[model samples]
Target: MDYLDNVARNFTKKYPCYLIPNQSEDKIKAFLTDRVKT
Candidate 1:
């Protein structure tokens, strides 16, 4: 759905890799947090 698309878009925009569907939410949260630090 749209939420997933938004997450995918934002994740791809901020990170070097596409966020895999199997990735844990904790990992995604950590990744986003890491981005905010830099």
Candidate 2:
């Protein structure tokens, strides 16, 4: 969870949109899903 928290923090720094609490969860899930596919 700590690792993911760090990733989320870094990600939000890069993409400010991810800071939206409501959308962040789905966005992060989608991001991880896409990464896994690649």
Candidate 3:
């Protein structure tokens, strides 16, 4: 589970404004589902 934990930590560190565990899963899913511009 270390890899998952690191990804979570890195995502939080990179996105300080986005809510983490407390955020609605839908929001997170939306972001990931959206295609990246680059």
- Strongest candidate by lDDT: 2
Off by over 4 Å in 1: 1-23
lDDT (10s digit) by residue, model 2, range 2-34 = 656577667888888777677685577568667
Clashes (backbone N, CA, C under 3 Å), per candidate, total 0, 0, 0
Ranking by lDDT: 2, 1, 3
Q: RMSD of candidate 3 to the true fold?
A: 5.1
Per-prediction TM-score, please?
0.40, 0.49, 0.44
lDDT of each: 0.59, 0.71, 0.54
Q: For residue 33, what is the lDDT in candidate 3?
A: 45
- Candidate no. 3 TM-score: 0.44
Distance (Å) between predicted and true CA of 7, model 3? 0.6
Candidate 2: how large is its RMSD? 2.8
All candidates: CA RMSD (Å):
5.7, 2.8, 5.1
Best by TM-score: 2
Q: Write one digit per residue (lDDT tens) for candidate 1, span 1-38.
A: 45554675676667646545546444666665666679
Q: Which scores higher on TM-score, 1 or 2?
A: 2
Lowest lDDT block of 10, candidate 2: 1-10
Clash count, candidate 1: 0
Over 1-38, each residue of candidate 3 has an lDDT whose tens digit, in order, gives 45444555566667777654575344544454453323
